[model samples]
Target: MRLSLEQIIRYQTEGYLIVENVCSHAELQPVIEEIASEIDKRADRLFAEGKLAELYKDEPFERRYSLLHRQCPEIGRGFDIAGYLGDEIFKLLCNKNLIDLVECLLGSEISCNPIQHLRAKHPARGSADGSSAPDYFQNVPWHQDCAVTSEDSEASEIITFWMPLVDATAETGCMEVMPHVFKLGYLNHQAEGGTMIVPEKLPQVEPVLAECPKGSLVIMNKYTPHRGISNRSDIIRWSIDLRYHKTGANSGRSFQPSFPVRSSSDTGSVLRDPDVWRTLWREAANGAGRKIHRV
Candidate 1:
């Protein structure tokens, strides 16, 4: 709960900053109902042990690895959910008031890029958006999330902590930054590798509707050009990004080595790292927690 120098000069001139609540729905509802009931009981026991196609078929790894849950450990999944929501989602993702509002807006000393969690914009309803029957899948085009993968990192001094577990107004689909546009660092768009949405590329940045509320928190900067528009209503946008790093900067990506089960209750024996122990055994078999109780 820190950050305040005019919110670090509006996160360095609108790279992004829309912090509001912080957290308190009884401290984020029992770890989000215990991680969404452990991801709906592993999607119904991997659809009844069919192995849910090992998550998008045979997985050779790369085809955006079938959207690695929205493309790789960006909190997309793989255990370590901030070590299991320990710290109320890590004080709102290392919230020293957003690390002094990202060290006075990228002046120095940031560090928060192991990539946090929460990002469920679901609602694609019965495929083929064939009008009616709970039509979902709203807007999320206009690409620019460090070019999807890692593209090498240092993507012009990263910064994108768009937190929103509720009240993101503008009809459920909030998130439209372009303000000041990260002083024009990286933006030539044409995504395909991981797929978020690109639509060719033209929006010189204009939308800024983040109306926030439920534990609010938004601060863009991965080249200051955002996206995420859909929810149209009926509600269901839930966000919780949290990606910072200036103190030397380069936390671009690193934290995939899990494998050290040993918590008979003493909760110790930490080792995890074999690709985050096989993505925490595939997010605990698609659940995200529970079962790995090594006590």
Candidate 2:
């Protein structure tokens, strides 16, 4: 929805803002059902191929991903936005409320960045202290969105909308961010352990936990340093982070596809068909591969 004056101020000043109830379960249910159907289809294939032991068809969506993961770590291979692109999924991308919130920060013209993700963080499988948890369950390293992009996109302004499909709690590995640091611009990041801010260069500010319920969104600017914690709870933490910038701006990943989803000045450039969106990625994939992140 259109952000309030105070909400805009908070995002501008703090580098991030936790917007609650920007969407309803009704709006997210379609995407959730699509995902569940995809899981069922994959499970059936694996079962017939003798790669999966049980279909687990009766399990609910929240528990199914982790269940399959425990049996086969590669259960979700290549399961990102491109892999899950469909009519329902495309409609969610053009969600009016989400676009409205985006417009408040990014103005009218907007292009959906290729730096999107569908995160199904598996539950921690170690001691309660979590010191021995696997890398899959570890907290994401502190890094800024801009630092991950190519040098050519260093000047472009991007915003991240981290939307969880279910309620997110601090214990369930909700995202956390360093506030009041977006103005500092890109910082030095190390190549080791994922491209992250250098330990010595990380800001000393207290990280704020972006705990919120389903249908809420955790908004952050391009330079905001944020990371998601491990899922200590039993269920998988399902979240999707979508990025957007002004149309025609450097999308950071020239090899992948970026779509014009909204525009005030050039309405005809905005893409609407789900089939076309899928085709764009298909064509990009068929071409030669290139690095998505600089690191």
Candidate 3:
């Protein structure tokens, strides 16, 4: 599953590349099933606590959360179970096909950054004032991934892989990126709308929509300016964003843990125990209150 020369060239020239069918539905079934189970568990708990009237057991995975939110707006506040890296998620992170493509661009040595996250962008609820409710996670503003980290990792070449668990269409808030903006280097970013590029610094180039189907991968350079669109559809737009860089590179957020997924030079360093990955996340969560390096 290494990228073709044409694909490599396009990535280098355009700052991003869309690799279709990188992983099949069967390959992603584990994570998808795990997520659905988690949602069911949450729904059950909410129902027991009287926050929800019905379990909505018959609803599909994409619509379950949205329907739950409609029943109880507060349901959206605590449904984020992505912080924990379960066995399924760990397996997906080290998927052979995915790492092969990563090795093509980042050499044989690879380290999975701790900045990964699984996003369940629910539909925006319209307010009585004729405006959509504020959706901090779904409607991301334009910003480079590099700008979200500390200056110490500016030299690291981190490649972000955005994979959708469901079809990411224009209506469902697919990613939008400014073409070739990686060549411009890091742009001045502010805290406005999720550490976005300053409006004055935005390039004149038109943004390109990264409409991806389920199991497709959208790879982007760390310096590329991109943002998630506002999900207006009825179903939740489920996706996962993972980051990888060369082994031993400064992971801008050094306070968090990173694990080596593959090492050609020193195979012993490659993480073989899923428990180690789980423990690392647990420790990070326990110490989350400490001072963390912010962009």
Which number leads on TM-score? 2
Clash count for candidate 1 is: 24
Clash counts per candidate, in order, are 24, 0, 0
Candidate ordering by TM-score (highest first): 2, 3, 1
Question: What does candidate 2's lDDT look like per residue over 1-295, in tens digits?
Answer: 6899999998999999999998899989998998888888777877778888977778788887777766675668878777868677788788889999999998999998888877887677662423233584567899998876788998788888989998888877898899998888988888798878999989899999889799899999988998878788767778888999888889887778889989888899999998998989888852246555556
Q: What lDDT score goes with residue 134 in model 1?
A: 23
TM, every model: 0.28, 0.94, 0.92
Per-residue CA lDDT of candidate 3, range 1-295, in tens? 8999999999999999999998999999989898787777777878989999987788888777767766777666544434445788889899988999999899999999877878887777662213243568477888888876778898999999999999998988899998898999988988756688899999989999999999999999998999888787777789998999998899877878889999999999999788988777677653356433244
State the C-alpha lDDT per candidate. 0.53, 0.83, 0.83
Better of 1 and 3 by TM-score: 3
Candidate 1 per-residue C-alpha lDDT over 1-295 given as tens digits, one digit per residue, 9 for 90 to 100: 6577787677778767787766666766755655555454544455466544334343322121213333222323443454444434544454445555555556533455555566556433432322221222356655556654355564437667776766787766687767885676666665343244345544555567767787667877776666666655443466677666554434444332222222233334533233444354345433234221111
Worst-scoring 10-residue span by lDDT in model 1: 59-68
Worst 10-residue stretch by lDDT in candidate 2?
A: 127-136
What value does the lDDT take at residue 40 in candidate 3?
A: 75
lDDT score of residue 268 within candidate 3: 96
